[model samples]
Target: MPSKYRNFRSSVPWIILFLEVVLIILFYFLFSDDDDASGSTNSYPAFQDVNHMVIFGFGFFLTFLKRYGFSSTGFNLLIIVLGVQCSVLIEDLLVLLLQREYKDGLQRITKAAVSMTAVVISTGAVLGKANPVQLILMAVVEIIAFHMSRSINTTFLQVSDNISMMHVHLFGAYFGLAVSSHFSEPSPRTEKNASTPKSDLLSMLGTLFLWVFWPSFNSVLLVEEKTKAIYNTYFALAVSAVTAFVLSLLTAKDGKFRMTDIHSAVLAGGVTVGYAAHIIEYPWIAMILGLLASGTAVLGSYCLQRCLHPALKIHDTSGIHFTFGLPGVLGALAQVVLLVLKDWTKSPRLDYLVMIPIGAFCLTISVALITGFLTGVIVNLKLFKTIPVSKYFEDQFYWEFPHLAVGF
Candidate 1:
């Protein structure tokens, strides 16, 4: 890299920080006087859990790469902070412009966290291939697209998805995959992309955090059916974890568990039950969804990922498609099934219930792909610093570390 390019790359974080400070000032002036903007105290605990998942769970989960632990956790924090602020501002501005009202503070923050969760999930797909500058750029654009797609899903399509099945998981997965496609190189997988035993252990800690707190994520926005949502999410997660272990044993060559499969497939139930978390009245139904999600996730991780890399030339660094994409689609299907079964006779808008989820599913994919590809183009432009293929998945490219830090 040229001296000028290095200088520019070094200044990117400062530039983003300055802009975020300015936005914070603008937000204070815009919403300071509105008494109703502050939300209820009751939501604090759930918000805390979701925040933990977004920060710690996601940050640690991406640290499975041997040489990229610092970048994984550090960039995860950076992208999340940027995504949250941008998402909240965009959502508030949109609501104020269209609805003549602002969302309450806790609600806005909670939703923003959820929105950023999608962005973080997307980050997993392009993890080692993109620079921090590129990731920040991608996140800002993604936040805007995320809110727009969500509005189209909820307001226009009237999708009954309460847990952001299509809006968050599916959209994030495909968007990231599309961006990964754009970032793909002809080079084959390298040793740096593989995880160390310590790193895998750290990543599994993340999995446990996500596994424990996911019910709160699924039920955070619900009121009437909060308990039901929690219950369903728990049942589904339990089944998925067991099923993931079983599949890992069956699929591995020596009957040993692959930590990669455990890291992702164990969480399949949470993504799978998201669509109907609040509405799945039976534990059996949730468990069935869990089983299916685990199978699909394991299959995609073990088999489909290899084929996808060559056929589509998309390098999914953390198997986001298996963890979030396929399971998300299954969740959407589960939503459709539940809606049809429950509303077929009682509700006159059965068609809306059935078709809206499907429409939202399709719409999310379209929006995510178009926006993601466009963002990829912008980030890949000569204006920004790009991660060279040789430097991919290595933290020393971006991080300043003392000798002692590497001793462990």
Candidate 2:
């Protein structure tokens, strides 16, 4: 291929990457100035609401990316990181917009309708092969996990617990569904009967809508407090994405891993940084941590997919290998590394050290096991068994499309 045309063809994706980096940097600078003016003597919660909303929204979006058309394995990986960033940031911005009061009944109705509409649309869009009832249960479990964090005394520990718990909940829900889809009583439908997974065109068409808006998700509120951390994340993501892109081509399963997975490092790095985004002072440490995180996430996901799943003969693609599982682990590791570094460099506090990981792990495990087991049992009993668990809600439309066959 001629360099000119090739560049022309690739220019769009490159430009999109450039714009995403620029936006993240721009946001960082804006926040950094505020932080500098405020000085290090003062510290706030680091704009958490914005971060939580963004992560939640993005995580939710990734679950349905295949249906939206970016089903290529590689692209889907990248979508995981990018989608989380985009959804969280956009949701954060929306919440900001919603904070304003409106006196007119018409405006109130419009806002209410818009908010409710978004919840409905987002839910419907992602449900795919999932039953609406199961989806509701999943959401309920997630909410319970969220409230559990409130009981913790330390803010840092609370945040960490929330991150870990939410992931476990997600893993439990998806894994439970995958298991039920396979082993549970004769459902008229199963994974084998699923509608062909759609290539998520929305991902390719938009060229990482979330990546471009990365800053909105990361530091919209605490840009000032964590300016350096914010910049580090963006800088790392840019480098990681380029690296992933080149490697993705070399490792392509035709289109299985999609070019997006090339940037898998970005998500791992982002999640790793997410833990210390507010207070990590050492630039060198942050850089090294981010780089190591990327490698770990990629390798970890691969090992889990190959060694663990096949051994069990469990083809739950949405479980430990994907969705929130690996990302959550990466997040936990990041916390550990940051904490270790702090303890080594500063005074060691054994009590706090022991509490962080133990507390997080225990909470996550309790929630996941309880939720997953119960959900599995419920689904196995043939109650609410009509729910869709495949990619297209194929079961629901089966009557209209008689040719569609389900399996165990």
Candidate 3:
């Protein structure tokens, strides 16, 4: 707790050491003399792409806010790093609990990346309000709950759906929103959401990173279907990105586009298509799904930020409900129609829907809400203590910043 020992750089060694120890234990337990543990070597490229998406893609997406840029990126890194480490341990433990063997190497890393993505998404709801420590603790709880619910869904219930929409998108969005209830009381509805031209350009970098690598995320470990998966994701994103901007200009009060629309809603296609990305054979259908997803998300942002914020009495810094949450639910719903109409029950391939997935979805919803609420409660307790309001949304409280140039 000494000031000298508690600085950011000083924390690096312990974090690295902890991660190394966990990885060693996992590798030890999972190491195999036979090559059976390792799946196709092709997953490596996808794994690296997913890592980038989790670290840079999600981090910069939240940096659209003006003053809190550093905290957005920095805290995102912290929570994700911790979440990735915890993911390996927790996911493997669940596998062992189910009497299944743990997978080694890239498979484990892929799982970690997906789990970390979920944690990152959840952080969006409470961005700039909580310190990195609270986010880390929240990830610890959420990841476990996510894994448990995931296990019950996959192993026992055997629902059919892709990993991202069900496991990452839905779980993260709801969990973060639930925690946002306790993140803070609404703060006079500030114009802090406004972005400068430069910030808009910077935000596009996040958007593009996600746009390019999302195929890898949706297609990971799908060796046979990876190409088709990538194809659908690409088209879906293309349509979403274009539709979001068009809708933004059409719907904006000024008849101009909202930068926030470009920043977040453009990504709705990825969330929408996630449910059926690999399964949908037609590119046109993917585009339509993207359009549907972006339409609701882009249009709702105008209304939700205006009406829902005051009504719900909670401020969601990221407007994540519109970007990730609603689109994710839409993806799930659209996939159900595809399943029944396409007669997926007849196919040998089963993805996320059946009775079990419905249960898993409901379970994740319940667990995430309860866990997030308790996390808020625990962080608020004097033992952990929430960050003071004056200190919120500023980097000065934690980071050591040099004197800035005028107007910077």
lDDT of every model, 2 decimals: 0.84, 0.42, 0.75
Candidate 1 wrongly placed segments (more than 4 Å): 1-5, 32-39, 160-166, 404-408
Ranking by lDDT: 1, 3, 2
- TM-scores, all models, native as reference: 0.94, 0.56, 0.88
Per-residue alpha-carbon lDDT of candidate 3 for residues 1-408, written as tens digits (9 for 90 to 100): 346425644664565577568767875885443334345375677778988998898888878777778888888887777677778777667766677765655777677887777788888888778776577778888888788767766766665435523457888888888888876653565655556777667767887898889888888756567788789988988999899889888888889887778777778888878877777979999999999989989878878878986688777878888888889888877776776667765756454335444566577677777887887788666544466665566666667666654546
Encode model 1's per-residue lDDT on 329-362: one tens digit a residue: 8888888898899889998887776777788888
Find the candidate with the highest TM-score and give its number: 1
Q: After superposition, how far is residue 157 of candidate 3 from its true place, in Å?
A: 1.2
In candidate 3, which residue ranges exceed 4 Å CA deviation?
1-40, 160-165, 189-194, 344-357, 404-408
Candidate 3: the clashing residue pairs are 159-352, 160-351, 160-352, 160-353, 161-351, 161-352
RMSD of each: 2.3, 14.6, 3.8
lDDT for predicted candidate 1 compared with the true structure: 0.84
Instruction: At residue 176, give the lDDT of candidate 1.
Output: 93
